[model samples]
Target: MIVGPAQQLAYVAADVARLAAAFVRESVGAAAAASTKSTPTDVVTHTDFESERLIRHELMVRCPGSTIVGEEFDDLAGKNSVGWIVDPIDGTVNFLYDLPVVSVSIAATINGQVVAGAVADILRGEVFDATLGGGARRDGEAISASSVSELGQSLVGTGFSYESTVRARQADRLVHLLPQCRDIRCMGSAALNLCWVGCGRLDAYFEKDLKPYDYAAGALIAAEARAMVDLPERNGEQFTIAAAPAIYDQLRGLVA
Candidate 1:
């Protein structure tokens, strides 16, 4: 009855993603009853907590002995080294507004290193997933990062923080970056944005003030698809950058 992390990636991740997608689909619109988190712009809803509860329950039943870290609740202790990072709704604002850009993300880590992960684009019904050494995929088909070699030709993706002050600084940085790349997009969901880079929909992506659950799944998927990924860290604040090898350095330099 024991399920390895790889099996969890290959099977459980997708299963949970579908479950999450169903929950999102069923709860869209005013019924979500959204409420503000840090700012009026930062939203959450009953669906977010419910989705995480469902996912955590499933993970506990299928992959027992694994820790569960979720955005909506405190960490759940486990007896083994495996850990499940969950972002039940990665773009809650988008979900609140009935935008089709939200997603559900889950990742499995062992000894603090992510080994498997999945991101479910709820509105699109696409699932992006990967395991360590196993290539990334979207809806079961293999995917890869773009090969665009120059920043001027690359379409980059990014997100702003909910804090207005932080956003002011981020906008200031973007002022320098906007004119350098082919273009930039703010997709709202960091997880999906990273998956977009993995699938070649975007050549690069960067953002500040993210949580571990925000990029855990998508980072693994991007890296597995041959994209270079740097998760946010504590140099006074957290930030993340993921890009195709060809344009990573240029993009990083501009953002830095």
Candidate 2:
């Protein structure tokens, strides 16, 4: 079965989301185990690991030849040119606290470029999806970035670094940009923040210390919905700034 990239990606994404939601529901009665990967503030749970494993297993079954790059998984599944990127539990800390803003994100990349993506807002039952040239959608309904042309009228979102040392720099950057905007929100989930931006719920978003999986799917979804995405200025930096085209220039200037 030679499925198209976009179709295949969509299938994998939907499958992952379904499995992720089940994992979250199952964990409600499970024991809370605090585990650290690199630092204390950066937390991982049994759910995160279990969810990633489920997502991986489903992907392999659906697309046998496709490669898999996931946060919870260490090595790539295969070296196929086309692959899937997965973030089983995007907001692990939020999920741990039983917050309703977490999500599962998945993207299909061909030759290192995203071709399709989806982010499932677990608590809201919203699934934002997009294909390379196909328009973005929220649960089958089309979505687009906000039309706000002025920064004073725009509502923006951003995320903080888990590492304390880098978090100060993010806070300092926010200080210079906040006064110029209408308001700012610090959402714990990077993928959901960007998804909301795509659906016209947020005018702009920026963040630091994000991995490829965190923004890969959301970036494509926003871009397909007519939003602009910008990468961090410094090399090896994990910063990202995504916004509606109307205020992209103005907001970019504020952050830059």
Candidate 3:
């Protein structure tokens, strides 16, 4: 039973909001129990695992037979084109430190393409969402990228990869970009940074080695808000640069 794009996005966003509340309940002011995933700094916490389980259970109950991929779940399972990709908690470090910047991100990808997505900023009680051919939104109001036309005047966002090698490459890229942008920020939450770009709160965003669940939903929300999307290398690795259409080319060129 295929669902219309609008209803699918709405349903996903509603579920994201519900799961976000659960995450906050388990995370806020609580002692974090974390372990390394890829390295010492790349961590995952108890809340992350619990949130993903709750979300997956609810999603499967609602859309039986649909494939689901999550940061904390088994990646081997159903292979339906209409798949759900999720990052139960995008900024585990921030959550551990009691920072108010993490989010729960979920996306529906149809045959390798993201068709609908949602990101719930649990700390802020805000949801950013979009669907293919449907304009982006926060809560219920429309949103869009900034109109900044010059890279030198644009505020930018970025994140480091869990892989040390990729993080080194990104650090190198930043050396070339830092002198060109008005300012650069590494907010620790890729999903939230992309949402900020979508809502014109940030001028642009760039990052590499991000998983599908990390950036897919926020990237779609950015594009739906009229941001330009670009990939520097098509080597099966996920590298992205998204910005308001005006300065997008300039930023993309720099990252490329």
lDDT digits (tens) for residues 130-223 of candidate 1: 9889789998899999989899999999999999998999998899988998999998999999999999999999999889999999999999
Q: Candidate 1: worst 10 consecutive residues by lDDT?
A: 230-239
Per-residue CA lDDT of model 2 for 194-246, tens digit only, reads 88889888999988778888988898888888998876434345668889898
lDDT of each: 0.88, 0.82, 0.82
Pairs of residues clashing in candidate 3: none
How many residue-pair clashes does candidate 1 contain? 1
Clashes of each: 1, 0, 0
How do all the candidates rank in terms of TM-score, highest first?
Answer: 1, 2, 3
lDDT of 3 at 1: 78
Q: Which stretches of candidate 1 lie over 4 Å from their true place?
A: 1-4, 234-237
Relative to the unseen true structure, what is the C-alpha lDDT of residue 51 in candidate 3, on a scale of 0 to 100? 86
* Candidate 1 vs candidate 2, TM-score winner: 1
Best by lDDT: 1
Off by over 4 Å in 2: 1-3, 29-31, 232-237
Please estimate how well model 2 matches the true structure, expressed as its whole-model Cα lDDT.
0.82
